[model samples]
Target: MATLLHIDSSVFPHGASASRPVTDAFRRTWEEQHPQGTVIYRDLATDPVPHLTADAHLAGFSDPATHTPEQAAAFAARVALIEELEGADAVLIGAPMYNYSIPSTLKAWLDNVILAGRTFMAEDSKIKGTPVTIVASRGGSYAPGTPREDYEYVQTYLRAVLADTLGLDVDFIVPELTMAPQNPAMTELVPLYEASRERALEDATTKAKELTERLAA
Candidate 1:
């Protein structure tokens, strides 16, 4: 059975934030669909990724074949992160939009995962592809063409990093924006928030099922 690596970085639980609920919903559905498949969950909020140091940066940019001991060690850590991604058939990222972008912890995790010549490569000046799914939660609405659309840097940047930098085919499910000031205020927003969470969870499960079938095929 296929293995799924789930990552969640939300600071809040199901009520205050959508990330946890969305991820939980997806995992539940995925488990039902692929009973034999295994799920590995990593919570960045609880156990965060180590920040990239200058030495780590230098090591990543250096030639692996000619790396010094320190550089090699750093490279090894990065390789380990990439290996996690490589070992999994699919990945689910549960992230809440913070300041119009992903949390620093999530970004650090991405930095560790997207290593040159490992997760991706420059083949004939073009990048190949892998597959990833992101379940994003935001406090306010920011769809394209909307006034707050420009605040959607989180999704935009994530798409670019996963696709262009890491060569991953990234899919996303954004629990429609909640907590916006509306006519009905809390009464209307609460239901909308709950509905979005349910939708996100369902979407994740469906995607996992489809992915597992494809892998099996």
Candidate 2:
């Protein structure tokens, strides 16, 4: 049976969050394709993972036998998070843009899982080539040719870490201009937002089914 690691870092709930509904769509489709498959879920907003501490950072580079009690405890927590990523066949993340970047909760999760000589900087990493789909929702458009394109750090930063560094096969479903409906000044962009959102939902469903089929093959 396939295992999916589904993570949602949106501060808002399903109805209010731009990224959560799209991720939920993808997960629902994946579940339909694999009725008995396992899903490991994390809601980072409510139960955020610990930030990388000095002990945790040092533990990754030091020998296990040399770890002090503090390092041992911190590294154990880090290992549990890393093991979750290594064990998953696929990963889905709801990464809503906050201040033109990813949520700090998501960053904290990455810091814990991205260990040197293990998930990163390793030739034969367990998570290498694992499929990962990121739903990157933003309040305003920062796509190519947009005025704020250069400010789009969420995807750029995540790609650097999740794909380039970790060797995961990364794909993205972006829903842009999310504040159009709520913000009076951006009322003109509401139609565009709707279109983008619809497209994201379709992409999520299609990608989910495609990944399931690929995994079965």
Candidate 3:
């Protein structure tokens, strides 16, 4: 059976997090298609991984046999996280924008998982061609021509690391204006917010089924 790595980094609880529900939708759809498939879940909000420390950064490059106990422990964490990513055929990420960027917890996860010569190398990437679906939720509008279009960093940053570095096959599902309902300043865009949410779910459902079929094939 296919294996999926489902990761959620939203600080908010499930009911309050916009990205969580969208990722949940994709997960539900995927599970329906492959009831026996494996799902590896990591909730970064509650169980955040430590950011890459100086030792951890150096440990990634040093030979395993030469690692001291301190360096070994740091490198061990990266190995475990990398193993999870390497074992999965597909990945689902919930990346809610915090101040026009991804959560620090998510960034920490990335730093650990994207190791040189392990997740990637000079000529080829170890996780190359692995499909990754990112549900990017933003509070305010940041689409083309929007006032803060250039400020959108979540997708840009992920693409650079996941696709450019790790060589993952990446696609994004953006659910914009998530704060419209709660922000008085964005009250006028509530309808658009609803529409964006609906579209996000629809896109997730379709892409999920497609990915499942691909895996089965």
Candidate 4:
């Protein structure tokens, strides 16, 4: 069976937020499609990962065989986080746009997971890659190429970090404008938001099924 990791960073569970509900919907559909697949969940809101500290930084840069006791411990913790990602066939990230960026807890988790020579590598003066999906929740509409697109720093930052730093092929789905005031634009966005959510769930489920089937084969 394929292994899928579900990572949620939403502070709010279901109130005016697309992160939790949208991810939950995708997870449900995925499970239905792949009954034999295994799913593991990590709730960053309830149990946040530790941020990168000086000790971790030192250990990360040190040679594994020459690491000190403290550095070894730090390295072990970071290795555990990387192992989680390495073992998974697919990953689902549920994140809400906070101040036009990702939550600090989720950022910390990413720091722990994206380790040098683990999730990424600098070989032949270039980096290799992985794949990731981000289900994002936004309070305001910020479609790409639109006038307000510049306001979408969250998606932009995420795409850069996953693709550039960790060498991950990142896919994003934002169910936008969940808290906007009633207006003509808002009315137009309502159906758009619903359609986006539906497509996001379908895409996630399809990817999960494909991964599982490929692994089985």
Candidate 5:
């Protein structure tokens, strides 16, 4: 059976989080297609992983025999995370924008798994070419020609890391203008937000089904 690594970094729950429901939609569709498949899930907001430390950073380059007690503990935690990514057939992430960037918890996870000679540039990397779907929900529109297009860092940074560095086959489903319904200043954009939400859910379902079929093939 196929395995999926799902990571959710939304500070809010499914009912309130713009990104959570969309990612949940994708996961539901994926599970429906692969009833017997495995899903290794991580809810970063509730159970955040430790941030990458100096010990952990240096341990990746040093010999195991030379590791200090601090390095051993820190690096061990990172290894578990890396192993999860490597073992997955596909990955799904809920990375809602926080202050024009990804959440710190998600960034911490990335720092742990993105080792130089392991997940990044290794000749025998397990995660290389693995398919990854990212749900990048934001409070405002940042598409090309948008007023805040230049402030969009989530997709741009992730594409560079996930595709350029790790060599994953990356795809994104974005739901924009999420704050329109909640923020009075953006009340006029509510319709656009609703439409974006609908499109994102549809995209998530479609992408999940397509990925399952491709994996089975």
Candidate 6:
């Protein structure tokens, strides 16, 4: 049976977070498409992983047999994280932009999982073809030519780390102006927000099903 690594990093809970519902939509459709598929769910907001540490960094490169108790423990956690990635048929990430970048929780998860030799090689990434869908939610519009385009660092950083470094081809389903309806100053953007939100939902459903077929094929 297929397995999906489902990760939510939004500090905002469901219903309040745009990324949350889009990821949920994908998960719901994915489950329907693969009734027997396994979901390795991780809520980074609720249970955040510790940021990368010196001990963990050293442990990542040390030989397992020579590791001290501390190194062994850290290495073991890293291994487990990598194992989850290795066992997944696809990955779904709820990556909401915070101050023009991904949440610290998601970044921490990446730091923990992006190990050397295990998930990648010196020249190429091991999981080069794995399907990764990122639901990228932003409070402001950042499409090309937009005033904040240069400030849109979430997708660019994620792509570099996931696709360039880890060899995963990532696709993004973006929902822009997520805070428009709530922000009085954003009243003019409500229409754009609504349109983008609707498109994001539809895309999530389509992409989730498409990923299943891609993985199985």
Give the runs in model 6 whose Cα sits over 4 Å from its true position: 122-126
Per-residue CA lDDT of candidate 4, range 1-217, in tens?
6667889999876664568877887678778766887888899988888888877878887788888887888778888877777777667899788888899999998887776665667552122344466888787777877777888888888887788777766777677776544456577667776777677667766765665565467
Please report, as a residue range, the 10-residue window in candidate 6 with the lowest summed lDDT: 119-128
- Per-residue lDDT over 118-188 for candidate 1, one digit per residue giving the tens place of the 0 to 100 score: 56675632224455778888887788887898778878999888876777778898986555434355556
lDDT of 5 at 97: 96
Candidate 1 residue spans exceeding 4 A from truth: 63-69, 122-128, 180-188
lDDT (Cα atoms) of all candidates against the true structure: 0.77, 0.97, 0.93, 0.75, 0.97, 0.90
Clashing residue pair totals per candidate (backbone < 3 A): 0, 0, 0, 0, 0, 0
On a 0 to 1 TM-score scale, where does candidate 1 land against the true structure?
0.85
Prediction 4 TM-score vs. true = 0.82
TM-score of candidate 5 to 2 decimals: 0.99
Per-residue accuracy of model 2 over 92-204 as CA lDDT, tens digit each: 99999999899999999999999889998888899999999999999999999999999999999999999999999999999999999999999999999999999999999
Off by over 4 Å in 4: 122-129, 181-217
For residue 73, what is the lDDT in candidate 5? 96
- The alpha-carbon lDDT assigned to residue 76 of candidate 1 equals 83
Residue-pair clashes, model 1: 0
In model 3, residue pairs whose N, Cα or C atoms come closer than 3 Å (at least 3 residues apart or on different chains), thus clashing, are none
Q: How much lDDT does candidate 5 score?
A: 0.97
TM-score of each: 0.85, 0.99, 0.97, 0.82, 0.99, 0.96
Q: Rank the candidates by lDDT, best first.
A: 2, 5, 3, 6, 1, 4
Instruction: Compute the lDDT of residue 4 as modeled in candidate 6.
Output: 91
Model 3, range 1-217, lDDT digits (tens) per residue? 8889999999999899999989999999999988998999999999999999988999988888998898999989988999999899899999999988999999999999988887887465557899999999999878889999999999999999999889999999999999999999889999999999999999999999999888778
Residue-level lDDT tens digits of model 5 in 1-217: 8899999999999889999999999999999998999999999999999998999999999998999999999999999999999999999999999999999999999999999999987898989999999999999999999999999999999999999999999999999999999899999999999999999999999999999989888
Better of 4 and 5 by lDDT: 5
Candidate 2, run of 10 with poorest lDDT: 115-124
Candidate 5 backbone collisions, by pair: none
